[model samples]
Target: MDYYNGHEDFLDRIEKLNAIGIALSSQRNAPALLEMILQGAKSILNADGGTLYLASEDKQHLIFEIIINDSLEIMMGGTTGVSIPFDPLPLYDREGKPNNNMVAAYAAINHKTINIPDAYVAEGFDFSGTRAFDRKTGYRSQSFITVPMQNHESELIGVLQLINAKDPRTGAIIPFSEQSRSLAESLASQAAIALSNNRLIQEFRQLFESFIELMAEAIDVKSPYNGKHCRRVPDLTMMIAEAVCKANYGIFKDFSMTEEELYELKIAGLLHDCGKVTTPVHVIDKATKLQTIFDRIHLIDTRFEVLKRDAEIEFLNQKLAALESGNPQNVPSLEAKFQQKIQQLNSDRTFLQKCNIGGEFMRDDLKERVLQIAKYEWVDTEGKLSPFLNENEVYNLNISRGTLTPEERQIINDHIVVTINMLTKLPYPKNLRRVPEYAGGHHERMDGKGYPKGLTREQMSVPARMMGIADIFEALSSDDRPYKDAKTLTECLQILGKMKQENHIDPDLFDLFVNEKVYLRYAEKYLHEYQIDQVDLTKIPGYTPPAV
Candidate 1:
């Protein structure tokens, strides 16, 4: 009221408007931004009430977004946690004519600002709803200004309707001046652009998330076994991270993750195994030592059949010759020798089959048996004798752990290296700059003995260490792996505890993981019912429960 003794100063309002514009442009959240826009517009004019309506996506209606009634102390939508009970106002009738009867719609449809000094006497717009509201609430509705919110291209984004401009000097209701209308129009323009930019950013985020999902789908199609690992690891990662966040007694008691930081961890978890896409599916899905495009144990079985057939042929030939030479008594010994050879061959074949099966560890004795079995000779198709097990078959059959040879294991480990290489080149936002670090560091060990970068515990972030534990736990308890049986919860925690003792994983994190029972939390969600067996904390190696 400094300018006209009863009105707001024009210069001060302009400066305030510029500041509000800056604030609007910087806000990233949609609801907060919409709420800011309405509040900013009202503050400039000291308006008593306002209700912002946005054009619906279908363009057939105006949807209420933020509603405020200062005298009644009623606020809804935006960030208020209160919802508007009103439905969207139709922009057109069922017969497809412009709905000019509604004041907000008229301003939006005509791209004109409607300035009513008093709504009770305003013409050409419906005030029946306003009258009904006033009658119900016993409050007078007066002094309206409806401004069309449009972008630089003059496309209507929404309508900003201010109610009852108050005299700064006396607090009496006054008509919105021409200056007020102009300022409101300019503010709506700025707010629209801000909203548009935020929406564009949101859409891009959605597209990026969708791309991640598509990558997951590709992995599923590439190898379903690994696909399950891909999904469950993230879940388990978050479970541990959250437990750390809520820790009340460990080294992690002071640790916490903001929403943005947790979101970064989550994205990293989702992308941790993304480079597995480049891994060969055969090597990734190798279920048995002698497995290639198919299991080679069957080939060994056929060779055993040929060896038995040869032994039978030789026995029959010798027996017939003995009978021809009038030594029929030799037939029983020949038959006994043949039967013994057949039994030995059957036993050797059975042993080789067991050796072909994969497990966590292969015994030295079993490996030596494979080597001795490899020395057995068989007739080749060209009539030349050849060793029963070729060099490659012997190597595959003698895999010391799981189904993969050292070379195949290296090929599998290269996936983490590939993940690092791929993510290092990605252009994540500043807030998510640590995604590559978190995702690629999962395979690293506390003692710098793990693969790729081999980050030590102190050299890595807590989240990366957390990811390592999650990766191990998920692999341990997961039944979907091609090489190992689904381990019980106790078994999984026992391995983690040993890893901690050996400096393969962070000790503090392992303690927290055990004390908090992050493994059981994960097991309940991802493990099979049988895998969720009784867990005894006292027996977990290198792990001690926190004192109560």
Candidate 2:
């Protein structure tokens, strides 16, 4: 009957150990896992208190990771919001000798467990600090079970120390049983494996996030004008996404994002412009209509100077010919003609200079004049007559909208396609599978007229649509773009409202944007002081202020 009773108790302990192992395996958080490990050992051995110490990276010291004392009602570290102020215990003495005097350090250094029945009378180990702690707390320090936490490779990762086991029947301090020590050692081994796995997973996550940010930085570095674009877009995207999730009444009322989803969206935003790295710098930074490797306007200026010099030379030759023919009276008329020619040339030069700049709109008459200027003749370096503006130059100067020519605009727009292709090739996990779709669809429009895939508002996901609004708003209000100055908050809202009216963007989102003042919040964070102008909500086209 005695043997059977002992066997039954052993089976009960084994069942508890199995349950504890399962719990440890499921815990992904490191601090919580450590706390659980210590708690499991204490419960198994009926220990009144415990401390878990993790070995430092250098393997010379064990740092206090978690401490729990049920008798003193003390709990520090491990999500308690209370910190351990004690110093780390060293595994070795100053002379590089193993510190076998300390029970916990001895276990870590020698790869063994130290089960002391009575710490006060224990030999060959230090208990001075433990006794001091007991004196301060007016509590007796007795039995101790120190277990070394070793990984699968038998590497010492940490130490688990439990103190003052209690007799269940008498409720008196007692020595930990041989069975209790065995259970603790087993628990420590499982805890070590769990902790190691959790740390490895967390390290991989941090490395992946850091690598994403690095790629975003690399894209920004390729163009000075877009230095913070990759960073700011994610901020705005999250802002808008969060706002959508908060709307109480609308199509987005039921919208919500989990923590993982939010993280995935943020990653997508960071990588949205990554393909811009492949975009030609000349096209990306084309500040003016005539800008390429350098501002070709300077070359045009030199041509104007040549034209003036030639006119002067012709005038001097005509004056000398009039003198030789005794027809000096015609010289004044000739001089008047030369002056008029110079004046006309100066006026045309000024006009061409003005046309070289990029603006929101370019009139047809201005485009016609650019073509006319292209027909003008100039003497080339090879002494041959050439059109003052070549075919490519004329096409560039006649750009109807922003600085980019049709071909250059196509090149710039191709980044979205490249972004899709690049991201699609990546072996993303299930949670991040939508990254390519979200990143690639930011440039798509509401009316099925947008780029690459021409995805309409109905076809795109809500997060992708949110990114589109963010991208447009950021571009409109950003002072960093090379081609234009930042628009005021008022101007940006008005343009966005007009886009809604034209079905260029989601009307519902635009309404939510204005009604919620998402733009104002973003302006306070990112926009310049001058750009944050007062906006009249009533005046914004197609935007009605929400009734208070």
Stretches of candidate 1 off by over 4 Å are 1-8, 322-328
Candidate 2's TM-score reads 0.92
Give the Cα lDDT of each candidate.
0.88, 0.89
Per-structure clash totals for the candidates: 1, 1
Identify the leading candidate in terms of lDDT: 2
| Candidate 1 global Cα RMSD | 2.2
Give each model a TM-score.
Answer: 0.94, 0.92
Model 1, position 248, has a per-residue lDDT of 85
Measured by TM-score, the strongest candidate is 1
Candidate 2 segments exceeding 4 Å error: 1-13, 168-170, 246-249, 323-332, 511-517, 544-548
Lowest summed-lDDT stretch of 10 residues in model 2? 1-10
